[model samples]
Target chain A: MGNFLLVTIQVDLYDRLALNLEADLVQMVNKTGAKGVLIDISAVSIVDSFMGRIIGNIASMSKILDAETVVVGMQPAVAITLIELGLPLKGVQTALNVERGMDLLKTMIDESPIEDEQEYPEDDPFAQ
Target chain B: MILSLSKDNIEVVREQDVVLLRNRVKEVAVKIKMGLLNQTKLITAASELVRNMLRYGNGGTCLIEVVSRGRDNGVRLTFSDQGPGIADIGQAMRDGFSTGKSLGLGLPGSKRLVNEFDIKSKVGEGTTVMILKWANG
Candidate 1:
């Protein structure tokens, strides 16, 4: 199994399904030892606050497990709709397409500094 | 003259019904020859409001209609729920304000994706959100 999980949301997902997908993705990331997660949403035309939050949650959850996430292939209209909705998707990395997303993942994984310091707490040992 | 393609309301009582509502909205948008972008926006809005109905309104019904006024064709959606009505419609419409644990973009985001948006809620009664997206408008 590759160290990357690629998910292409092919439909306009309902609320429950999106939430399920987020759960599944996080579990999958842990099971597969995934170093990167790339979600392709070029086909997705719109995302509300709920959808936006799920997407953001996926990235955040994956990152917590030392995996980098990249969302790619956002349609122009979708981007505009998200912007107007005031959801900039802060802290989530985005790319133009799957191809570039893969490259970004490669770059991110290679240079990732989280793995080094994450396991070793920077706090003073006397505090414990 | 715009022939009546379809118009109806489906009860959204469960999770499966939310999916059904979105598909129904997509179907009506398709029948009206709505552009791909508009169709997506319509379906997205439908998904948002339908979920809102289920999560906040204790389940309800969504009215999906294909409307035409002269040369302009449109898809209209109306969601009504008999749940705890919003006490402050203005606060609910504001971005990033949520009573629940969400990004709180459901109402305002749905409003931005369509050509027309209207909301009416009476505390203790219920809430109704109506939207219209005209093709090529």
Candidate 2:
């Protein structure tokens, strides 16, 4: 929980709101320096292709900032709609619920191999 | 033998109208005793098309109707817009084809959610999209 950011989408999000959330979530990741992000969408009933793109974008953006994102609690209906919409949510991790999402995120972060000390010499400016 | 039960009209003139349209679609789907998965498909398809109307067509009119063919009942939606019409209907229906900043899934994706999908567009006049989803089918 210390290095994780949690976001729960409780309402059906309009286009503008969904876009804004994508921007804000990425900003939050940068600000908090969180290692992982968990987005709960169990309450959201619809996931159009646009919304699907936003979720995918969030995952890609967070990964760029060295943060892993796990979207959790998707309704079964929503999942079917997304697939029918031709958005399989590739490259994005998903979980059945928040608890599982958190555990998955933790495992992802923990399982990442530590960088070898020799790879980044102390004199390398990028290492800092 | 498709018989129309009842119908309503909604104007898509703004972003909120799309949201309102989604809710209205759900209401109609429920009134027809549509299943949960069918309702979700209806609402989601309505949301995608209505938003397309707002974005490309500068808003339009949507006619929502309940229809029955034999014993099977379904919801039908028709969206009409008098905006800059699509130049190529064939290309437009293809997935991943967009003139806007979107994923280009609205038209094709909406088609997949409904039982029937039809589109008619004239270059200078306008574009119309109609879709139907049966309650049990």
Off by over 4 Å in 2: A114-128
lDDT of each: 0.85, 0.91
Give candidate 1 misplaced runs (Cα > 4 Å).
Answer: A43-46, A114-128, B1-6
For candidate 1, the chain B TM-score comes to: 0.94
Error of 1 at A32 (Å): 3.1
Which digits, one per residue and each the tens of the lDDT, describe model 1 over residues A14-73? 777998999999999999999999999988766877889899999999999989999999
